[model samples]
Target chain A: MSSATTTAPESGHGHHHHNPEDRLALLKQIWMFSTDHKVIGIQFLVTTLLMLMVGGALALGVRWQLAFPWENMPFFGLLFPTEGGQISPEAYTMLFTMHATVMIFLVIIPVLAGAFGNFLIPLMIGADDMAFPILNALSYWFMWPAIFCFGASFFFGGGPGNGWTSYPVLSAVPEAAPGSGFAQFFWLMGVTLVGVSSMMGSVNYMTTIINMRAPGMTLFRMPLTIWGMFITAILQAFALPVLTAAGFMLVSDRMLGTCFFIPSGMVINNADPTVGGGQPLLWQHLFWFYSHPAVYIMLLPAMGMVSDMLACCCRKPIFGYKPMVYSMAAIAGLGFIVWGHHMFTSGMNPALGMTFMISTVMIALPSAVKVFNWIGTIWGGRPEFNTVFLNCVAFVSMFIVGGLSGIFMAAVPVDIYIHDTYFIVAHFHYVLFGATLFGVFGAVHFWFPKMFGRRMDETLGKWHFFLTFIGFNGTFFPMHLLGVAGMPRRYADPYLHPYLENLLPMNQFMTICACLMGFAQFILLFNFAYSLFKGQKAGMNPWLANGLEWVAPSPPGHGNFAAVPTVYRGPYEYSAPERDDDHWLQTEPPKSSPVPEPPKPEPTPDSAPVGEDTGSSS
Target chain B: MSEISHDTGSHAHDDTHHYVNYFLIFIALCICTGISVLFDVFKGGIPKSALVFGVMAVAVAKALFVMTYFMHLKFEGAWKFIILAPTAILAVGLMIALAPDMAMHYYTNDAPQVKWVGGEHAEEVAETEHSEHSEHQHEHGGH
Candidate 1:
């Protein structure tokens, strides 16, 4: 195929030729309530990045309390000077609770699906825009209400202290804790709105991916990123309604004198005993039902993007593409059944726990398949050691650690011993912070030129990655040992207990490392801001990726392509013997392809079509 | 590059519209609801398991009617099975998974049941509280 077909339209309307004032005005117009998928994706990216800082700050507070109990914290303690610059235990509870809340809801999930998914889906699939552009914008707009609700909760009764899971009785009864009343109500509202936002996005993605592929962009021929997104959309569509329903139920239980999750004869805070026959365990079942799959919802998109980046950086055809797709589907399928693993310690029956354990362990099979495929893709290839590649490698390495730790938690006996300990905390941080965030960082750099017309500074990016990698390991790895030493999570001060007193120094060390990790993010933020203005100009296809997105102009115009490109082969056709170039674009047609066929006239009653039925299948 | 001609005509507007009697389906759903309500109202005479099963069966029938007719799943292509089957399976699977703990209440004590203290016991409690309040008032008056 002629490259000129894709590049010709961009020549006349180059963004760089415009005056700075004109470009600024154009950007301002696009940034404000625009229905363009690219604008909405950037909107999500910037918003989530801000929320990531907020969540990170909350995490630092938790670390400070763990490291130096009851002593004056640097910035946070000043907010509570009435208690002699020390954070109250209730404040400590809120810190960790909101930390997880902001990280999972505002940062990881949105950054993956809302930011990268929205931006990449249309571009990668060779579509001009989403199937429903208005609905896509609405999805981005919906996130603000959730952010507002979560932010407002901090002012009202010190925010929801009952953890991110929001298990009811604590979440249901308003009088249960200081934050359980209006603050918890706000938290639930926030969660409900996030669900609404996600539901809208999932529907939009599903429709766009299924129906809006360009001519010849068949499902099998699409990149694994699209497949990952497609499967994640399906998972969200099926799973989110349950969580939405459960969230509303929890809300009702809190406000409307309903008791869906609150059992009868429960007294909280010397208050009157509750008088309803609702089961607390039911909440666990429902919450984990969505949240277990939610774990994959958080990771799978990153897994897909990492696969693409890995192949490009390694300059190899992805090893076992079909297997990768099948494995993602397998992971999503098994994710549902293994939710029971979360509820094993909640007094669920042993038989049910056993089934969950087995299912959870079985998820490892598909995950291992993906890991092997990624490794195979890396082997026997000339590799580029760019920032994107480093982060991709980190994602794989960290995910292995996270997935291995998860197996121990999947077993009934082992999990019972370490349930709610720092081990569970270590395991998920490895996955969420270690794997998903690193993958997202790689994706941001990889696609920065496509989003804008510039590349992020690689030198600063390397510094940021190394500091983060070292600091992240230093912070979280010892938490495994802390878990083994019986350091239960969500404690205000574990050192208060004699058995855990000696662990204080280790906690302090982790706290210092956490600070380092937290500060390293500033370098990233600075790099991003500086690069937006001063970074080197990148032409289209900076990474020389094989995906359809690479064919589009850097910072693609309103309708992404000058002409819609047709796919002739699968996305990962690197190093084909038929071509001298290492990478072959999906749209590139074969040199000697046959072109004799012409359209036949439609058959009528006088000239009936032979050998085929023309009737609709339905 | 030779542009491939897209067969957009294949997805042209179908003039043939399948009309379903939504009113009749709504009536069917109402009848199913009435049956469930009747079963629930007369649950005292029926065995608990039978009553639960009968009411649930009626509910399922109502859902089927709505899905097949009102939602036009019956007129949809075989892709409806692809979409609905996994959802149906997961829903049933979740229910089954939840049963061991939620339904059976295994190992743990049965869900605590709060008894309604009505008819006589409520009056006694009220009378005792009233006397206690009057005596306390009298003591306060004396003081």
Candidate 2:
């Protein structure tokens, strides 16, 4: 990781190295440290996957309990026995809480926002790498302390059980619960670290996307993955900081006797505490203000990847390409106004609830447009429903199912009834598992060839998708019914409601589905590892995607394209008659456009062939 | 392709162009923080959020001067603005969102355990207290 810099001097041949590589020393240097964006992206991806497995295993333990409540189980019950009884109420709460936190902050967000976002941004835009390489390394490292703190809570005391939302009355007072003190601290620190990592990553991505696009690669003539990452980064820049402040405020209230989130005269265990006059709702306002947008920050990049992959695999210009881009911006802009949807049942003002409801309903429109655009994208094209394409298509299907459930909750009256119930559970799983992780699977399969220069076993991948998809829906879809039947979420036992007798069977069924879903991840793991060593070699453009990354060598070198690409047309120019192939890379010139697009070559790359900028496309 | 460095940049000190505003700011903040700490520890009075934010305002002003002149964010690129615009939006958004919650703590009159807020409700309550017993009158005297 050293380079020679030629310097002009009286001694004409003299040059110096900023970091001179001496063979053995250089190997150690490269092994110990390097600030390459690709290296950092790979590091983030690997870290995210490791945490995913750990989190997933914890989830399996949880599912085991629900499937066979208070019974001796294979792995989890034995490991987490509470004095030879069942898993304790506190432990069960902590496990569920940490599982969600780890999966969201540690896995899905990092895998997309930090990993693929970093790995793809420079390559797609034809830059060597990210704008600030050293800061990139620091951001990844900063994530570790936060993770370590959260992990350490298991040993020091109870883990955070306030749910990933960390609603204040549950999270504020250290003495509020058995786990609140140390567990909540660890959770806050972990979340805050993630915020720092995301902000740094956002700054790097936005700057690179803006300042480092190759010659002739304008804004509109870029892949949707870049557009997704760009918007996600912009959203992160706006969202993560508010959450950071929220975490800091929570910590201040806990440790320093600041009454920022506690109101006077509240009784915890029939005892009044010293802290007073802070409102708990303040915490919710702050937390959700960041977290609601954080949902898009979590999911949008995957959507971008799926759109790009689906277009390429189908050999069609993406249907309503302009709508896809504008819809994303609309989603982000609308995201800020809708955080109150989460708090409608938390005793929010009825008027504000309606406003938030309308915004929440409005949020669904952009996504529905995306869903329509996705269906239309695959329709009327020479289709190739490969495992990658299936996963891509599945992302839309799952998102629709998940997204439609969101509309039910967005209606203020329905939300009041189902706010903290299993219906909410079904709604989000349809989102995180159905949509976000569905996109993640597509991304992993679609990019494995580019990332490793080897194709994943298609059959194994299909098996993985089928089992995960069915298991996911089977597990979550019933929750909507359970929630409507008054099955409260985050409960250790359904017996909390004596009258809800019939739901036990449904709960058991969902738990079984959840366990089976967890089991299928191993198929993916096997496919990933086996393919790394034993898979077929994927030459560049195996799927024949019309993006710049494919034109570069497979397992692209550090500099990506051998020649810096000059982008020439919209990313979705496909199936045109003038082109020999069905696709056109954005980096290719319209004048050099082999495909016959009927519209005249106006050469305006920033806008749609016929559309306006600076306004919503609708 | 060119290789990246394996070490932290050593030329950081060689440049020797330390920011004047940053230096002056560091000195000024150090003195102010010293005085504030002394006042709090000796005088037995601590600053509120408003005062702390005021101090932070001064520090932020100083830091911005340093970043523009020293860190060179001022001349960096349009992308830096692109990066920063959203951060500004989020900070303002959080304050806007948090304001109602803070206001609600004082405004929600139905909650009896909490004290009466200094508003029309408090005025109404004060009138009632004056009409009631001497103890209620004492409670309403300063409140």
Candidate 3:
């Protein structure tokens, strides 16, 4: 702590008040199309947070309906219809469908991979900017049209009623669902645009990571966070195109009179259908082909960030760093082969089911290895019970439940009962909400000072974490029981079933917990907003963390580094026996050697107006 | 050959490449398409499977030519093959996995009934297995 305090002065070239012209131009550049990765990252953060709020509101509505199945005479319920605020079946279908879509596509993916990945990669790798700045901006810009399409779908007639998977036959025909008309078209187009945006971001991420690493920052020298993001980017690059193609085929089915996914059904509403000779299962196959990898796409970045934060907070090197990296790689590689697991009950061949079950079970091995390594990393180390550390620990514990529960679904026998049940809902929420969402909370807290140049209130942050952890468990854990009791998911009314009658009290309880959880998130939102300006000023290396990102000033300038930094060691050099401080800087000179001053830049024929690289001799 | 240098600070690399050979490959692809069409035209006497195999071979050849030359994969280094090989293998593997489903129609016996529009005619669910089992066959024959 003393060493960090002593060194803080050197790094405190904090933000100074700029002239009016400079301030106006900076504001304009930030709000408009700025190519800086940091600004782009902020844009993604703000946009995705807003999307999260919208998705959360939809989830509340869903819970509201479930809590009081038919008694929906409320302020918000009036938006659906005049029938005493009771949610119509059509609107209820739209509620959960749009909720899943917005959360997965708009919030999680963008906030985790798009925002943090963009912001941290250049800083972590000691690069100035992404390989293609214009392309990066285009990736962010592409999301807008996708968002607009999603909003426009509601007004076109209704929003898409099909689940996020949007399986065909039901999703294909306008006659099948109320919103399956022009609205479905808008939904398809929105997804396609998002796919394109993700593709652009992935390409930029891959190229920049591969090509723009600073001198001495070899592949192995990279932080686990970068590796996580890198592998996630790779998954996105390959997997998203499959989804795009699926979306295209679906669009053709809807608009171009094609029967790619529509099966040869003789009757709909007791009337002979015009479309025929397509396979509905084809949609499931293609959708899951990308979607299964998409699960890793959401999880990997969080895993990576958690690894880094754990290493930092524990004041130790991450245990089995190589194994951790390999496990993620293995996870990504096995992700492709396990897509068939999602299709086991879709009238797929039993032999194919056996093959898929084996692969799906095998994929869990690497994830388990990662969990073991995280525990090993934290085993003997002194830990700071900061909000970041608390959330990260929650991620590990909750992810174990998420991972172990997946085994039940991966086994064909068990999945038969739990396929569309609340059990599956609980399984995914543990991973998505418990693991990834918690990771998001942790990473934001850990990096907020570097991001906004202010510290978030520690007391407030801890309260947010505890309430969220308790509320999340309270809401979702009972779902496993409900599922075991044979409660089916996506049904507007479970009261219709005699078997589901007793589950009403439990549902009511869960809904109350869910509302509490949703409200608890506002503490985070408030903490984030208030701390951005009014919180205590954060100096560089406030966490005393060992990474190149901490070497840069808090909220780094346009090009990030004052001079191109040469990395001398791996990111986690914490608690080295010889070092007096808990962490060692990657760029620091050895004790035997005096600090070398920057060499004068020699004029070159191809010299641009940009500052010359200052070579620091180690 | 256009040899443009992409000066991206510390990671400046040359992205410029020759284009004249790409045009030649395009011409070759055109010839291959013609050959494929010729196979289809003269296949009246040939076995249908053999004709399909011949056409597929020509398409593969044309695709390789385009990927290697027109797509500039030849000059793009080893990573191009590394990235592309797995994608090709997985795609083909998925197709193979789907072969049984493509070749067989399972709903000839008892099939899931389509939900009717407007929620009318929805109360046969009690004996749905027995009744729809016999009725679906008629629709299968009609298709």
Q: Against the native chain B, what TM-score does each candidate's chain B reach?
A: 0.61, 0.43, 0.58
**Candidate 3 colliding pairs:** A269-B116
TM-scores vs. true structure, each candidate: 0.89, 0.81, 0.87
Predictions: Cα RMSD each: 7.2, 9.8, 8.8
Mind giving the per-residue lDDT tens digits that candidate 1 earns over B19-120?
Answer: 678898888889999999999799899999999999999988998998888777776655566666687788888888889888886674533342335434
Once superposed on the true structure, which residue ranges of model 2 sit more than 4 Å away at CA?
A1-32, A589-618, B1-93, B104-143
Candidate 1 chain A has its poorest 10 consecutive residues by lDDT at A609-618
* Predictions' DockQ, in order: 0.24, 0.12, 0.09
Per-candidate Cα lDDT values, in order, are 0.84, 0.75, 0.81
Of the two candidates 1 and 2, the one with more favorable DockQ, higher being better, is: 1
What are the per-residue Cα lDDT tens digits for candidate 1 across A1-618? Answer: 234234322322244432345335546854689889988898899999999999999999999999999999889999899998999999999999999999999999999999999999999989999988989999999999999999888988667899999888888898888655788988989999999999999999988987688766766777888878877887788888899999999999988999889888888888988978898889888888889888999999999999999999988999999889888888888887889888778888889988989999999999999999999999987789999999999999999999999988988899988989999999999999999999999998999878877789999999999999999999999999999898999999897799999999999999999999999999999988887777777767777778888788777778887777777778888888887878877877656764422222333323321101111100
Per DockQ, the best of the predicted structures is 1
lDDT value for model 1: 0.84
Model 2, position A301, has a per-residue lDDT of 92
Tell me how candidate 2 scores on lDDT: 0.75
DockQ score for candidate 2: 0.12
Ranking by lDDT: 1, 3, 2
lDDT of 3 by residue, B1-143 (tens): 12245345313323355445566777888899998889878978889999899899999998888777767676565555456666676668768767665555454422234443214446555468568887999889899
For model 2, residues A316-426, the per-residue Cα lDDT tens digits are 888888788889878877887799999988777666777888989999999999999999988987877688888888889889888999998999888888889989988
Q: Considering only N, C-alpha and C atoms within 3 Å, which residue pairs clash in candidate 1? A: none
